[model samples]
Target chain A: MELFTLIDILWMIFFLSLMIGCGVLFYRLGRRSESDFFLAGRGLPWWLPAASVYATHTATDTPMWVTGVIYRYGMRGIWYTFFSAWCAISAFVSTRIFRRSLAYTQAEWQSLRFGGLGSELLRGWMAGWQIFMNMFILGWVGMAMGKLCNYAFGWPLWIGLMGFSCACAVYVLAAGYWGVVVADFQQGIIALAVIIITSVWGIIAAGGPGAIVSKLALMGESWRVNPFAFTGIFGGEFPFAWFITMMVISIIGGFGMGTSIDWYVEAQRIQSAKTVRDASYSIWAGTALVLVRNSLWAVAILGFYVMFPNIPSQAEYELGWFRIGFEYLPVGMVGFFFAAVLAIHLSTISTHLNLGAMYATRDIYHHYINPRASERRLVWVGRISTAILLLGSFVYGLMMEEITKWLIFALWIMAAGVWLPNILQVMWWRFNAWGYLSSWIANLGLSWLVVWVLPAFGLIPDLPDYLQFWALMVLGALIYVPVTFLTPPEKMDRLVKYYVMSRPLGWWGPVRKEAEWRGLLHMKGED
Target chain B: MAWIRRHWTPEEADEWQKEDWIAIILSTFSYIALTIGVALSLLMLAVGFIVLILGIGLSVLLFFVIDPKLKAVSSGYEKKQKEYLEGLERVQRWEE
Candidate 1:
């Protein structure tokens, strides 16, 4: 692996210091209140946090993952991110609703949606799972960065990854989400620059884009340029029917995302906005930026195939991005590329650290340990939680060899069970806590049987990701539908308040009618 | 048809949103322009300097031109959820 020169080292130092400077600035500007740190005191302008959202989504593994997909399935591989785009679709409509929900974290939402012991149980359960999910994501991405640094600069993996994790934790602890959002805005700009430049540079290195196309053509690939070209149209890895089915499911998931009471992970931005309109605008704006990001990475991957057609180790093709970064980029640009990587990693990791900490401090501490904790104490607890998450994720990262291997299982299979409940929670009135709880439990147990054990042991035939996703989504709906109908409906008063606030379009006709009768609504009824 | 309007207070109706046309036109064009620009830039990558300069220009436009327009167009959804929170707090107080 190539090493960083003194200039490269200096540039990296400058990059880190700029981030620290942001932390200092935010700390000074912030009022030291919990709301200011966690949600920018609810006064952020639209574009700032919009850019921050886009920046946070641009993770270290994103480019590497895109490159690997393109290499395997051609440029049409971008269709994979369509799953997340559904969230954007829902967020566009739901921004006002999510912001209006006034939930500090998703867990705190249960009490607002349901009543009594059931709401408490649901709140606590959701909190624990959400924290676990966040920690797992942090570890997976941390390991990717660790492996990347080790390869690029030969720094000890633990030192580079764990060391940087500490820096991010400190940055976050300094000013909370203010630092996270500010640093994210700065990082977003640099990261975008590096992505575009490196993409252009890589294509140039590969004898220009036209020549790269010619080389790829000679390699006899048909659908690298056209995104619509699915090999599944014929007998390929992905079938057309399966693609359509998953898309339908994702469209449904979009409704769930839009309707779901909590989005605490991204809720800070939603809450931080000066107006609901701005928060909504932020979602679409961030999506456009994301499109630009994906395009840059796609071009780089397309160029990579032509330049290094026959790297010895085919299995390690995911690291093909390293070849482009080290071999193709000029001296200073290479350093900038590394800085850009750190920028993306920092943006994503910091969000998880801050978000996870907020969930833990608010849900775990405030609910269980100290019901009347002071704001100052809560802020300190938030810091401690962030530090603890960083340490736990670092240890988890050390244990993993490759994050890519687990991703398919994690996103589709492991998380798929929640996909339906997450969707149903917003739309259906009858989905009680027991129904909600059973859906997840059934989903977990079903996924293990359908996607993992049976397929692995050859009891059942192995299926592709789309098939597994479709199966679990259908099975999850079936379980939850029955469970919801069988379980008692949520109390009328609780449901009526939820309907008026969130005002989502779904099976909340009864609640809306009641809200109307009670004179709770200020204007005409909405779906 | 918009949910915001359905629940809008009489006071809120007086608040006319000015031409969101800038955010509308700019974002649409930027999405298309940026996409087409990157495609052409990659094709024109043999002449790397040209694309790099174009890219720098586009990034500048992104921050300066596109961002402010979008920010100006809308900012109305802030209090939609607050009423719910207050209502829920009242319920809790009554239960206590």
Candidate 2:
């Protein structure tokens, strides 16, 4: 019989208690109004929101995914890190503009920018799509967490998933924004600590970096050099073009299009800041953290190659960092490491729950179901919606087998249907409400049709995934632009108001007269 | 516009607080130190892998592990700030 030591048991108890205690503390802090519950009363400091954004955006799958790429292609995996860093840089550059635009969601921006039936239709479509995509991504995150937990502790899949979901739901539902902010700050620290420890442990276990690399060199040149030398006719080791494209998409268009609104947690952070400059600084801080954190992961994955040269077929896509931690790290350190993973899962799930509820309650329920609903009723509806979304994600996690595949599919859908039209509207002045609606419908329809027809008839040519993504992006934009120009434009007055107030950078000219007429313009020291 | 008048204020004092200089200095130093420590460890690990492959000694890995202790201080500072923030929020809520 294997006997567990008192130290091991104590370590487990300490972290477990810490996790539960933190959840309860935030829950109490968040029990005020719905705003406090959903957005932490919009009073979080720049650093807290910044840390939360960084931690939540980079999930558990990140390290493993990067390791898998390195395992297959070698130095090329750095491209993914590069592109993701670029996305953070872009966010920093655009934070000021986004902060000035005070709409709660991108859908709200559509209504504010383009009024009438055209705006309503666009808002309704976007709300529905956002809810679907948000739920789908949450499910993927849950599945990855479940797999990690199952491997680490030998727990059942459902048990691990339910544990994460319930914890997330409890904190999010209780305090809304406040709980999420507090928990995110703690979780972010834990995540950094765990990743750093795991990397060090892995390096030590291999006897040293020198020994690990020597072993790899002895094994084969392929292991040491070009990891992606396997690309050929029948799907070689790594499709470089596809990999590069995905990385580019993740960095550039990923956050460029207002699809970032899918991240309600970030929006809450923006809302929390005391001023536009404060909000922008928070984004900058968050982006800086992500850049540093992702780079660490990239290095860690490369280290994995030196440590474990020949990954088995089944464990190819498994998180090498988690596997190494469980196998090599000390018993006490193991508990803290697992707690970090739990932090990643819980933060993402709770953020999604809050965001999904916001979309359903603010965009759909209040707009459609009960336009005159009281704040109390709206908050109740939000809680109910959050509970339901959590349950659905939990179930989806159970049903899904391959988490990476699920995430890729979700990203494709978001890139095509959600991102394409949203980017057009933000960057192009001629993109009208009718054009947004048409682009959205056309993108969804065409993507669905392509998925069905290509696979069914075996006509899906051997092409990289990014090729398909690029095709969709280009085609969606082409259709959206022409259709928008052909259709009657939205009311000029409303456009002028939104453009001036939001100060969005686009083709629109400054509406000085409109600003004065609306009594929005102010002279220095007038007050 | 009505909502704007109610929420927006021209008073600079009410709109903004003095930058939290202590918090900024502490956080920035902690971040820089932690980042450098991580980078050095990564570099050491890489060097160790090369040495082992070339039949060199395993002494470098020890250096990698020892340096991480320096990071503990930074982590302590972060924990302190987190606690301070939580306490401030609680006190504010109670007063309200």
Candidate 3:
């Protein structure tokens, strides 16, 4: 274990105090009302939420995940980290529509978009799933910190997992999203600054970029620098077909809400923006930073590879970015780097803590259990829920190693079969609640069979992940399409009201015509 | 008419048009260019500089084309947000 000097310890104490102080500072504003607590009174400028977005997604595991891919596949591995591009079209399309709807969460959006029992069912299912998903994310990310601490100081995994998360929960429980977002702004700036400094330091340590490039050429590994160095068309490790599938999933997926798992976190940011314009720009700008940061990390990982040359294990190589920071930085600065790592960990933890509580308090408690609840009572419930999620995450974190595979399967099911339906629900007027619900149900069974059961029994060959995505998509459509046609379309009046409010893009022709006919919306020329 | 519509009425902006399409296309291109360009540029490659410049240019064009339309839409929506919020509450209470 590396010894941290007194200066390093003091640095950690100072940053920790500053983060907790944000909770105390924002407590009054958060206590004022449910809106103030969860959404910063929905009055933030674009940059506030933008910073939160950048901070929230830059979790402790992010650099490791990025390092693993870049080290294994060279610069071409950047595509693996490109999934956040779902924000590209979403910034213009779904962000606009959802902002106009003024729904508190995607679960609430379901009720606004569809009517009757199916909408209610969808709302409850989504809220429960989101709450579970956020907790699961908290567990895994916390465990990542646990592992990192174990690597750095020989601390037990649980101590790192439980300690930092509890500290972050201070702000989340006290001031809700108000505390979370404000702290995130400071954390985001620190994380970005340190990331640039350490990465450049790493590049310099490996004899600078010029020497690194020349050395790679000498080693006959020059293709590692080429971003488009595909091994073959469809058969090799890095294939063109895989690239095409990734592009489609990343870009086209943006047309739908909840297409990427990141969308749910971003939905909160979208609603918190002061205007629809602010919301759109926040998502767009925030994701642009994410992409740029990934690229920075990519080059730094290349620097690490050139120096190490032949690391055999995935786990060891994945720690390359951290090693650069911990091993190379000046003595006093090591503490500062550790503080930045805490900032990254806290930013993610605070987001999930507040996010999971939102589902619990707003969608579950207030909507279903106590619609007549006071603002004070609701805020209290939010705090209580935050505490519950934190405690539950500890349990989830401890058991994470045993269940990592199953949870990953759960995440894949969320993305693959439901991806097209997610878009259709936003873009198509006749895509009823039943259709969407059935797709989720169909995908669960289909994903398990295709990914595990069938492969285990040797009924079918185990396919690559991209191929599994296609197979699930096609199989899911067969079930949901018939159910949609078999069931009646959503009520016209409801569709008309939704169209007048949201003005969503795509095959919304019939809804638009009905809205115009009812005089709820005017024709372009008439207006 | 200008190739890109800069000024939009709230009513006109509510409709999806070529401007929105242009913004989407440019935005996607910018993401691709910037991601690839920044990495290579950091390595001091000449081609990286060209791609990075293209990404910046595309981003600027995207913002100009879409910002006015978005502003119009936002102003219109803000006026109605109060009413929509009430509707949201009713749905939550199962009173609609």
Per-residue lDDT of candidate 1, residues A400-510 (tens digit): 666545654555554566776776676678778777778777887888888878998899788776677667778888887887788789999788867766666567778
TM-score of each: 0.85, 0.77, 0.99
Count of clashes, each model: 4, 24, 0
Best-first order by DockQ: 3, 1, 2
Runs of candidate 3 exceeding 4 Å displacement: none
Best by TM-score: 3
Kindly list the interface RMSD, in angstroms, of each predicted candidate in the order they appear.
5.6, 13.1, 1.0
lDDT by residue (A404-427, candidate 3, tens digit) is 988998999999999999999999
Best by lDDT: 3
Q: Model 2, A331: alpha-carbon shift in Å?
A: 2.7
Q: Fraction of the real A/B interface contacts present in each candidate?
A: 0.32, 0.07, 0.82
Tens digit of lDDT per residue, candidate 2, span B1-96? 221122223222111122222222333333333333343345455533443333212112222322232123223223343443453333223323
Report how far off residue A7 is in candidate 2 (Å): 3.5
DockQ of 2: 0.06
Better of 1 and 2 by lDDT: 1
**What is each candidate's DockQ, to 2 decimals?**
0.22, 0.06, 0.83
Better of 1 and 3 by TM-score: 3
lDDT of 1 by residue, B1-96 (tens): 231123334223312222222323333444444543554465554433354455446445434433333333232333344555466445433333
